[model samples]
Target: MSTYTVTSFASASPAFTETTYEVPRELPAFHVFVDILACGVCYTDLYRFDAVPGSICGHETVGTIKDVGPNVNHLKIGDIVGFGYLRSSCLDCHQCTSGCDIMCKERKLFSHGPGGFAHAVVWDSRFVYKIPSSLEPKYAAPLMCAGATVFAALYNNNVSPTARIGVIGIGGLGHLALQFCRAWGCQVVALSGSLSKKNEALSFGAHEFLNTKELTTETVKAQPKFDFILNTTTGDLPWDLYLSLLNPNGILCLVGFQEKPLEMKSNHFLYHQARVVGFLVASRGVSKKMLEFAARHNIKPMIEEYPMTAKGAANAMQNVRDGKVRYRAVLIVPQDSSKL
Candidate 1:
């Protein structure tokens, strides 16, 4: 019986601990083994730190295929690919058949096993996408999650090219949202509490930057109405004021995770016909399209890199917790396959 050992960083009580797992040589049909090259650290990872002790957590992963199982003709050894939040979904479900696999009840998430924070992982090949040759592994890591998410909001909503879009928060997700909306030919407005992000937001392609801290309800209502608004921050904000800034029949999409239940006035829905909708990462098809769109448009996340060591993971997590990571943080695994 041939077997191999996989090294991973598992979540501990206060930090991450090195752990190892043994796997059989034979993979299940339709699966592929990926030797991870880079993984992006996300706020979602921080949220799950203590949720399951000893569990590996990382969803934005980019790697090279090391092996492929029976029926896996689309991917081969040495092919560079990426995996996002979805692990696998039963293909027979209605949602899966319609290409919304993310909504399938039997969907297995990266949290189900040793995730991207590992030397390698075996996953259903259908959920993995080949990274475009133009995208470097490190730069492509964040796209698996952050980029896919914001892109889905636009793509799924059928946001028009002439739509006036507003992106709340200028962090990891918001930065990417700005670029995507601009590339799609929308009028992009960046909303952030701090004016310090104005220059960076504009550079990312926002047509205007509004400091939310300086705006009153009346002031927000007086500003030009947006056809769509994407909230990408976890912090609770004045939802009613945001709703007031939307044009009639506009959509306010929430992509951030907030612990508190949302509260907003009913007038927006009644009078303006405003819609509030939320979605998980993205369906597999949308994720693939997002990567291709990003590559063609030269959209990339600004990231800080750290080595994939126990100490390095701790430092990166701390930076994310302290709200210091400018845009995104990526963990670069050493390239030696022998060590892996």
Candidate 2:
């Protein structure tokens, strides 16, 4: 009954374009229709665009159920839910059957097509998750992707409560990682390029701060601290010195997507017997658990919000790519989007 446009990112100048499309009153038996209240702008949305030009690009979405299919029994009208990177995954895959749907080989991503840039999204019910009633939609939007990614890194690794943890690069992921580590009872240290976020990181419960700009490789090599070092920055780093900062048998977890391939001496990992590992996003259950934990702990992203119109979204994406957004950028769709 509602008519709205599906916004798409393209190869043309100005980048974002729109097309008017009507929402069918009845959804497919396997789908759930969502009234999108907010959608988060992510770096992946911009990085992966060449693969799906002219397709809708948002993946972090929070909304209410507007309509439900006949087969959807668990969710009902007016329920609040969130959608992340996964659009739909084959339910019968080994990964799906093994309680690792996020790793499903047959999973289709929402990186393209029918993305909810407008008022609503009709999507696979399996990928959607209910949000805590008290969580704000705009704040909850990033929880679907950015928050889940770091929370998975911390949760899946079984970081000890007494461990000394260091979070590198106090940007989108590091900011949240510091808080999660602190709340998990670890003594958190933030390593960043400048002291700009020192006070903020302390306010977020970090116990110590290290400005990487001031610490030389020799200084860090002499300092055998931190049980775990989480590298959350996007650029190449002094990976060797970081490995040196770890204690014996310590783990260095990489969650950032860097442009250049990094290099480090095998001795750093061999002599001390340290580990270098990577983490992906979490399973649906973990995602929900993370949100619940965030809600309970009052952990939230520092975000700058933009309206859902084309121009607003365009400016937000530019700021994100430019690294001008404070911590995160969220696109706030109108409460009643049908009017636009």
lDDT, candidate 2, equals: 0.81
Q: Cα lDDT of all candidates, in order? A: 0.91, 0.81
List the candidates' TM-scores in order: 0.98, 0.93
lDDT of 2 at 58: 81
Q: State which candidate has the highest TM-score.
A: 1
Across 211-289, the per-residue lDDT of candidate 2 in tens digits comes to 8887777687666498999988888887888888899989999888878987989997779999998877878778888
Which of the numbered candidates is closest to the native, going by highest lDDT?
1
lDDT of 1 by residue, 1-340 (tens): 7866888888885778998897777988998888999999999998778588888889999999988998899899999999989999998999999999999999998888778888888888999999999999999999999999999999999999999999999999999999999999999999998788999999999999988987787787579999999999998888999999999999999999988989999999999999999967889999999999999999999999998877778888889989999899999998874433
Q: How many backbone clashes does candidate 1 have?
A: 0
